[model samples]
Target: LVHILSHSGLLLLRAGVQGLSYAYLTALVFLHISREGKRVSLPRALLTPVPSVPSPRRYMCSLSLFHYSEYLVTAINNPRSLSLDSFLLNHSFEYNLAALSSWVEFTLEKLLFPELKQITWLSTVGLLMVVFGDCLRKAAMLTAGSNFNHIVQNEKSDTHTLVTSGVYGWFRHPSYVGWFYWSIGTQVLLCNPICMVGYALVSWRFFRERVEEEEITLIHFFGEEYLEYKRKVPSGLPFIKGVKVEL
Candidate 1:
């Protein structure tokens, strides 16, 4: 009877956390829409307060905040790049899939083995990673203001120049480095071990390819200037050397 009671309590707790998560997301959406001078059709139920708890749902809110900040920073730094894509919430189906997978994994693990749900220190670390990574990425964007674009430029525009100051001086690809760590941090925040590992591996692979591809264009655009910058700074990602060029 005690065991059953404990499980029921856990279930209820999870429900409350999930409810709060939904409410938070709804509120954010309404806030965004209202800011844009659009009518907000928020449900009445969303206005009802829900008790919050330490859960994966909290991290999910963090993720939404991340996307919102990404949009806000772009709007400030590179207004020309501002568009629907600036939000980055629905940039790709895979992004949604990843978030879904993390939540599913966390839910299953929590339900089946409640003891595994809380790794306090690890979650704290994950939160730190999210905060720092987001800051770093935003800093890169600001430093590269006008030079930063959501998409890699194949053709160098007059405004485009090799950015090697600030975060760029620290990491050849500071924005990518920040984003790569930030992706893994989300899974870690959820305490989904499988998802954490999966996120790390996939993020590493994606950034590795992207860094190399972007560097090729960098070389084409700035020639010796870019090559010199590449030589001075590290790729900023673990085990990623980026493109090789003989000086």
Candidate 2:
């Protein structure tokens, strides 16, 4: 009886961990899909002023994980009927192979650390920082990108009014701020010293690029109005100035 209970407990723990992993994976995918759909559906005028609506498909897909969890539970309950190793491998192969390539690479590297003794905590932290920073930066970029329409060929640029509400009210580039925090947080959480240097370099490069691009575009479209606004408001960091302009 004790042996049977011990085996059951171990199986339960494995099933729980596997289910949690799938839930997280599903949520991340759903979020990405939703963001993409919102970007596609946004109107040019409203892109500047309001939040975009994510797609229904993302919600539906995320909810489908419950069905997957049920299957995992059933499989766990009938260990003799199902080859657990083969079942897990097959299910993961089908569900996560393409969708989680980066995660797989990271996991493999960690798993093989015993063979590669040089892999220190600092290195892991650094990797985590870069990953987190990039993710945050991308999220902010998408948020800003969805709201602004880029006109590539027009010599005479057009500004779609000033955006001083929502995240814009705090920082001229909320996306950059988000990215900065993400990179820092990731590095700290992962405790990777090597990742910190890489994160710093990556953060600086992207920050400069994004700031220049945004400022140039704003200047071209808004002209003196944007210049004056820049002077009044601190660029990059969020420090709201009491300056108001009639756009």
Candidate 3:
């Protein structure tokens, strides 16, 4: 940032910083909500807190297990699940890349074309994309409820049935759909055209591989029901029909 300031006069870095800030805020919101450990109407829950029946206990019990416990859950389920670790890691990678990409693009564009300037409309559109994309991805997670665990299991528990409602009604992988847009939005919000393209390509490739692997497991678990679901609903992109099944 100091180097960018020395070259590009500081305002150029703001967009990059802002994009990173949004990612941070989104992560914090998700983490806090997820840790609260209940699947309820988040807005209502936050706004209307229930009075405690018992006195507030002064306790921090580390021994008590939580669903979001990464290590323990990983132990319980399949560690090989790409949905568990890889997707989250990819989420971080996408944001980090946007932060760097935006900074680099701004500095270079400013230095290379000192007279020319980035268009205002691009920034406006980028901002909208970021906001909308974030909402879409987060909505998918919340809507899916218990069916939306971090892991992709070969053998699902009795309680863990397939989700085909909510956003899942229109798309097979709405979270992935949300993420695809969000990843691209991060790059665009930073006004990094090259990185935006790069993000799209990389993310699409990963989603392709991930969907193939995940759907095979899904088919095994859900049987013909999953096949019917796949036949009816598009996987990622809405217009994309006839998605090839690997297994």
Please report the candidate that would top TM-score against the real structure: 1
User: Which window of ten consecutive residues has the lowest lDDT sum in model 1?
Assistant: 43-52
Ranking by TM-score: 1, 3, 2
| lDDT per residue (tens digit) for residues 49-129 in model 3 | 222110011000100111123322332333333122322433466655655665577568668874323444554455455
Residue 218, candidate 2: C-alpha displacement in angstroms: 0.9
- What local lDDT does model 3 show for residue 51? 27
TM-score-better candidate, 1 vs 2: 1
The number of the candidate with the highest lDDT is 1
TM-score of each: 0.78, 0.40, 0.58
Q: After superposition, how far is residue 76 of candidate 2 from its true place, in Å?
A: 39
Cα lDDT of model 1 by residue, 1-247, tens digit: 4643353344435657653543455366445323134443332212212222354544645676677667667767776566545667556898778878888898899999877777766776776787678789989988999898888889989888888889988999999989988888877767789998999988899888999999999999999898878878999999999998765
Clashing pairs in 2: 122-192, 122-193, 125-190, 125-191, 125-192, 126-192, 126-195, 129-186, 129-187, 133-183
Worst 10 residues of 2 by lDDT: 41-50
TM-score of candidate 2 on Cα atoms, chains taken together: 0.40
Candidate 3 accuracy as TM-score: 0.58
Which segments of model 2 are wrong by more than 4 Å? 1-146, 149-159, 237-247
- Residue 121, candidate 3: C-alpha displacement in angstroms: 1.2
CA lDDT for candidate 1:
0.73
Q: Scored by Cα lDDT, where does model 2 land?
A: 0.43
